[model samples]
Target: MTQTLTGSATVDEVMAALAALEDPKARAINESHGDDHGVNLGKLRAVAKQLKTQQELSRELWKTGDTAARLVALLICRPKAFESAELDAMLREARVPKVHDWFVNYVVRKSPHAEELRRGWFADPDPVVASAGWALTSERVTKNPEGLDLPGLLDTIEAEMKDAPDRLQWAMNNCLAQIGITHHELRARAIGIGERLEVLKDYPTPPNCTSPFAPIWITEIVRRQQEA
Candidate 1:
């Protein structure tokens, strides 16, 4: 049986509760086990509403020593919650990698501020930041038609491709394939990128060829491009 946490706990209190658990699996289970731990969309809205006012607190929260605190801070500091100054501060100060996925989902995917965040990541030396930037560009291509600055985004991807770590290349290709399926204009582009990937010749075959993200997707993209 799982224990129910009252939703009344403050964010700091919830972080403390999460930190108290010594077992990693148990902590994960507890954090995700109920609506209480679920992202509070209303809280997100409130944070978005206070973007200007809460900028400093958000940065401080992100810099906290506690991992859970930092995670929660990243959640609250969605792309919508950031202005130019705040975002620059976050790019410089936030050190935790655990929030990268959260940033991808909440801040970069559908937010208006993705461009600035992407620029920050592109300029950063950290592989994690670069990888996150590549993922964000892919996500923008797939999810947002008008939201994506296509030429600039594609240029960034192409530039990064030259020196992208193998993991980043794989992720970028996966995103490109997703964009190809969603956007007709990108289908030809995806095929070109896929063919270029194949020429790498040294690239390892990813496990599970039949998965949606496998080389099968690349082949399909190439076939569709030829058909067009």
Candidate 2:
């Protein structure tokens, strides 16, 4: 699957390539997370590498509505080239967790309209879409916190995070963790809020991997930063 494809590839050809790369084990794991794609990312990236950035081909593959093909399209598509409306349409249409996450992380985050979309989607009634908005907010929380209302964010999390849908809860938890890890003044209150809400507190985490529980995640990341 890592073999480089020569010449311009067609949508049918790329879809077939993706189908050929499917693995049952990977598909099972992805299915557990609400994604249907079985093609490993390495193989997908290899295919995208050969195809290069083909925006038209990416659009065609996306139209096919196949998970693997959509992922390849995401890889080969130019992130910043999309118009804001097009990105909004794609975000709403991309309901699959992996595809939604990729579109937000790989494409929308790089778009000139990231802030615009973030603002528009934050309070969108659709929790999944709102999750993408929160995801974007988390990025800004980590990288650029100057103008953001840190306490206001905490107030919202305190009110809404406990019963948020799975995806939205995860995104909100990430934002909470980031605030606690980044701001000394808010760390104790953030941890307290997390303790009260208990979102992801019981999630099963593998050995040595950080838990999604904000208190633990924030504390652990802060500890590591201190050591570094």
Candidate 3:
């Protein structure tokens, strides 16, 4: 469903539009998943589509303390307009994995400070920050690995992956898999570290699907790349 909205919206106007678009089905699913914020308006992308300048809308949406609103804010916000400090504050305020993931993938990844934040956050004591950092690293390697210190990254994963937080470990595992898939020179080392860590070795996978166990994941991805 779409709302008939135009012009710049104040936070209150956006909230009202969100309420008008509320989807009971979506709200139920979000609640079942333990979403902290109440009602969900389902796809607000159309609304965001109408608003050209997202910075002001993003600021206003975030202040409302609603999950859907914040998601819309991520969709609309201009990554370049945000300062590193502002992004840091947003990350700190992000209370759930989904929020953090979107903020990192959508906002941080597009920002000029991506490289700096990825390195800094990977070492942060806060697991969330560290997880985002590793995730950013995975994204970076997938797109470009020109200046990355492959040896150092592998060493870090080998040394600390076993003791890392769940989210961070997942990112580390992904990074290792990415290394094996994208960097032929480092493939063997990445596979070795994955085997040593035994990352997601026995996790369940959908039928006919290879497990995300790093070795298997890396092997399958590499095979596909070669075939293509």
TM-scores of all candidate predictions against the true structure: 0.57, 0.96, 0.87
Q: Could you tell me how far off, in angstroms, the CA of residue 195 lies in candidate 2 after the best superposition?
A: 0.7
Point out the higher-scoring one by TM-score: 2 or 3: 2
Q: What does the lDDT come to for candidate 2?
A: 0.90
User: Compared with the true structure, what per-residue lDDT tens digits does model 1 show for residues 157-202?
Assistant: 5566546765466556566666666666766675566555452435
lDDT of 2 at 140: 94
After TM-score superposition, the amount by which residue 147's alpha carbon in candidate 2 deviates from its true location, in angstroms, is 1.6
lDDT of 3 by residue, 27-131 (tens): 677777656444543457776676655788798888776877887788888999988888888888886666777889889989998888887887889887888
Off by over 4 Å in 2: 2-4
Question: What TM-score does candidate 1 reach?
Answer: 0.57
What are the runs in model 1 whose C-alpha is more than 4 Å off?
A: 1-12, 25-60, 76-79, 92-97, 108-112, 123-125, 145-163, 185-189, 195-214, 218-228
lDDT string for model 2 (1-228, tens) is 634465488887887788788899889988988898897788788898899889999899999988888888898898888899999998998999889989998899999999999999999999999999999999999999889999999999999999899899889999999999999899999999999999999999999999999999999999999999
